[model samples]
Target chain A: MKEVFTMWKNTKMVVLTAICGAVYAAVLIPFKPIPLIPGFTEIRPASVLPVVFSLFFGPAGAWGSAFGNLIGDFFGTLGIGSIFGFFGNFLYGYLPCKVWSYLSPQTEPLINHPALWLKYIFTVLIASLGCAIPISWGIDWVGLIPFSVLANIIFLNNFFVSLILGPILLFTLYPRFKKWNLLYSQIGEITSEKTFLQNIGFIFILIGCFGGLLVGNLTSLGHFTGKIGINLIPLIFSLILGTILI
Target chain B: MSIYLYLERNTFIHRLHPVTKIFLLLLFFILLLLFSSPLPIILVTFFLLLVSAFSRSISNLRKIWKLMFILFTFTIILWTIFLKNLNYALAMALRLNALIFTGLIFLSVTRIEEFTYGLNKLGLPFRVSFALTLAFRLVPSFILSAQTTIQAQKSRGLDLETGNLVQRIKKFIPLLIPILATSLRNAELLAIALECKGFGIKKKRTSYLDYKFGRNDFLTLLTIFLLYFLLLKIF
Candidate 1:
């Protein structure tokens, strides 16, 4: 216990990072979507604080980032679904952010090939749906959306948006705050962004479409819709159609 | 420090892998949603609460008390004016209470560190996991900073407490500008701190603590299996 406190003593960076996340949440309250956009309902992808924490502190920092986001949602975006805010925002913000960070040069050499960036997109896709499933459950049960059906429909609505949002946050915030020991490895690099990100971005958009289709279908198939084609056809169409364009 | 706010003892919940908990929570919530009726849900909810207490997460009840009150009061008010049916309102309130308490129990017993280790062990990158740790460390500091800033301003005769709703909100804005400004500058410094470390030099990184499976994890898995079957039965 003392070690934990001792590790953080005078670590103003940690305090400041949390404050940054809270402030981002506060300022973002007014920008929340009106539910008019089916999937693009969230206001800001505010990954700055989480990105900052991951870069500066390490894995522990990333968890704090998720916690910080929940706190942000609690004070800034409280709603009927406030109970689910922790999971919803945690997955939406931190999960994807961490995945991207892992694939970056900042992480130890796992799969160093440049093409792995393409694979990274799929990781984000898995993470998005991965986290979305739980969040959707919370959002659905809390009655945040009138029906669980509609909630599932819109669960991964912002999957692609977060994909784009997360990498940028990581690229921007990491270079400025990463620690001295870790910085030595990538001494000249400033941010995580580069040509890799551009190529990866395209891959992510594609993956999002595909992952969305997959989730959309699995959900509709498992769902008990008595009418023969009532729930089945449109569900496949939307997922497939979105995959093609997404 | 409060036992009512955070579980005091280590138990299955306090010991299970955080990532696993994260997954079980999702499954649990989905199962919770399969029914609209209150009878089985009432029984399930009662059982879950008992399990939470047994897991030594009774502290969560204290933290959720305020939100529970708000939900209860809001339901009552709405029911009195619109539905005119006490039964429906009470049922809805009970359902909501069950869901919220379930979440609180999950959070209170699980340490953020456990989750991070679980995350890293389960293939999440060290940098990302570290980000989570930093944020947890920072939250307490942030609250302190807010208090200090508020006290500093109040000492200078700032009238933070003496205005109407909009006026009071407006007053806070001026105070907020400095806080925001300081926070951003702090973010920049933190960014530099990260940069100073070899953050992106490698493709993989090592976590300080390694999370692995054990007897406690096995117990959690059994619990998850039992709960899953029970939920399926009810839903």
Candidate 2:
């Protein structure tokens, strides 16, 4: 968190962040009509970007993604939802980089080994789940969509869409970026054994995916009719635990 | 597919302070959420449309009308299924329209730089706001590069159009990769330029442009707050 502020003071990081945001918005703005769940989510080719750039450009990519989503919302669907969208997109970009750095066996992210491939996929999964939980919670909190429907929509949309596509973009761009000496690895290795991001990841996986599924099942079974508030207890508890761990 | 949303126009809505417009955007968004009745939603939708007309954003509105119509109709159908009432369906549809149109009007009328200036006035840090503004400037160029990348891939017999859902998404990688690579290269060059120009030497920075709340802004703010409270009281 402290590094985020210091990174903001650097001119090079600032410029790079601007460029990443602009390029992301450019990809997103024109694809407004290709809706998967009309009036809510869409087929976002820009979805893969956070993963790709997070690995390549580090914190700048996270800030760029957060701001880019904010600007993109002004095009349409600007509301209370935009706040969640902003933070969700930030984590979308941030978590993968952090997870990749934390979990990667190699000094830098590469696909030369089979184990690294699994780590890459795991990073995307954790990152996508991290994104879906809060956003679905936010949507449900706003009373716009059910937690079940939105959680599934966002999780599947992000995970499946990027699962195949994200790595291809990563593989395509990685060598070039590495050749140019622009990869985040060149900046420094960010892995720290003391950080609680792993606990945060496990908490998200435990609560966000499993807890959301339990609530969805209970709701469908008519066990919790008109009791959304009561139903949120365990989910909220896990979130609090995750925050406390952080 | 490349749509530049901001239109330069000399109109009352265009000339209004950006912060006022931002406030109105937020207000309309909240109002749309607050009011479930069709009448207030319709009223807000009509108000936004009237503002759009005055701003001469008809062309921009035309680009999105089909999409908005589909979304509105879908909302009505879904509401009808769940809420089991035609009027409730209509209200939900109207609410969706108000939410969408308010955003469109704001984007169409506000210039990118004016928006950044508005953020600056509202106490956002200069570097952060400027990064966002710079992103707006760079999007058009990036769009062009994306189109060229798609074309280059097409020339190599990469078919993006003919595919199943998964295949189509997979096909997008060819287009996305080159664009991303080009964007990174461009970003590195810009970083070098910024370092050369001494972008971070001074912690305290000054801006040549300024935005101030005027008599009109105050009056507009008062009217909107009154209208919002009145809407709340009425419903």
Candidate 3:
């Protein structure tokens, strides 16, 4: 988290952030004509760029993803809900590297082994959910889109695109980035220690995000009843607290 | 393929200071959200249209009218299906349209530099603002590179249009890899260039463009506040 701010101090990181953002927007803007949900989202195959850049550029990637989505929104979808879109994209880019660091600190982001592949899948799932929860909740809470509708679409879109494209991008580009000394690990000192607080925070993120999704779906679909199901403010707070701690 | 919506007009709205424009944008967003009923929302939409016309940004709106129409129709249909209420659906659709139109006007009037400068004035960090402006400028070039890659790939017998969604997406891999690689290489060069030019050596920096807080900005801000209160009272 500190690196997210600290990376701005380094000129290369700043340039990398801009590059990541520009590339993402470049890929994204062309897809604007093809809408999955008009005025809400599109067929965003460029979603994988953030995940891939996350593994390589770390904090810069997170900021890049956030800014890239903002730039994309400037095309048409720029509105009050874009604030959530910004944060959602930041999480989409931020969570993958953080989860990967926690899951396998020593190894590079390669997918040669079955265990590594499973970890990759889990990492993408968390990142996808991390991105979906806030945007869906915020939009739904704002009375624009339903929580159940958006949450599922965003999750599936991010998960499937990243799951398919992330590995190929990583496999081809990881070595090149490492050789160029542009990987976040090479540029910044990453602490490998697994602290107790970090483990707990990770669990909280899992529970809060997944639980919010489930509860949101159930309540919106009329499967859940009572006061607890009606209000999502508590879950959102937990999710925020989880990310902060993690 | 150009992403920028800014129209170079010498209208009053275009001449307003960046901060004032940003404030007005936020104020309109709040106003839109404060009302869920169709009548008030429609009024706001009319007001926004008037503003767009006065600002000479209606052409920008025209460019995105198709998108707005589709969004309006789909939102109404979706909400109607979900909530079983046609009036509610129409209201929601109008609300969404008003939001989009407001954003369109903002973008149409505000340049990238003005936007970043406004954020910087509003307490965003210089580095962040610089990166944002840089990213905005870089988008067109990246798009150009992507187009070149697509053409090169097509010449090499790559088929992008002949597949289902998944297959079409899979075809993008070849296109993406080359553009990404080139961009990464260019990033390294850019970083080195910036470092050589003493990009971060000074603690403070000056802008090339000098935007003054003129009387127009002040008047616009006051009018916006008054309009907001009046709308609140009327609603």
Best by DockQ: 3
Name the top TM-score candidate. 3
Q: Is candidate 1 or 3 superior in TM-score?
A: 3
lDDT of 1 by residue, B1-235 (tens): 3211345575756766677776666656665565555675687688777877688766556655775777666654444443466665666666667766666766666666775677676786555456555654555544555557767877888884465433443444344444444555555456557667755566666656665667777777777788768766756
Q: Model 1: residues >4 Å from true position, as ranges?
A: A1-19, A22-68, A72-246, B1-8, B76-88, B121-125, B161-165
Better of 2 and 3 by DockQ: 3
Q: Lowest summed-lDDT stretch of 10 residues in model 3 chain B?
A: B160-169
The segments of candidate 2 whose C-alpha lies over 4 angstroms from its true place after superposition are: A29-43, A74-80, A105-107, A143-147, A195-205, A213-223, A226-246, B1-3, B82-88
lDDT of each: 0.49, 0.72, 0.86
DockQ of each: 0.08, 0.52, 0.67
TM-score of chain B of each: 0.82, 0.90, 0.95
Q: Report RMSD for candidate 3.
A: 2.0
Superposed Cα deviation of residue B20, candidate 2 (Å): 1.8
Chain A TM-score, cand. 2: 0.82
Tens-digit lDDT track of model 3 for A35-95: 5555666557898999999989999999999999999999877998899999999989999
- By DockQ: ranked, best first: 3, 2, 1
For model 1, residues A1-246, the per-residue Cα lDDT tens digits are 122223332234344435445554443332233233333233233333333333344333433444555555433132335544454444344333335443464563223356654754554554455344444444433433222343343344444433444444445434443432332233222235445544554355444434444544454344543422233334334322322221
DockQ class, candidate 2: medium
| TM-score of every model versus the real structure | 0.55, 0.88, 0.96
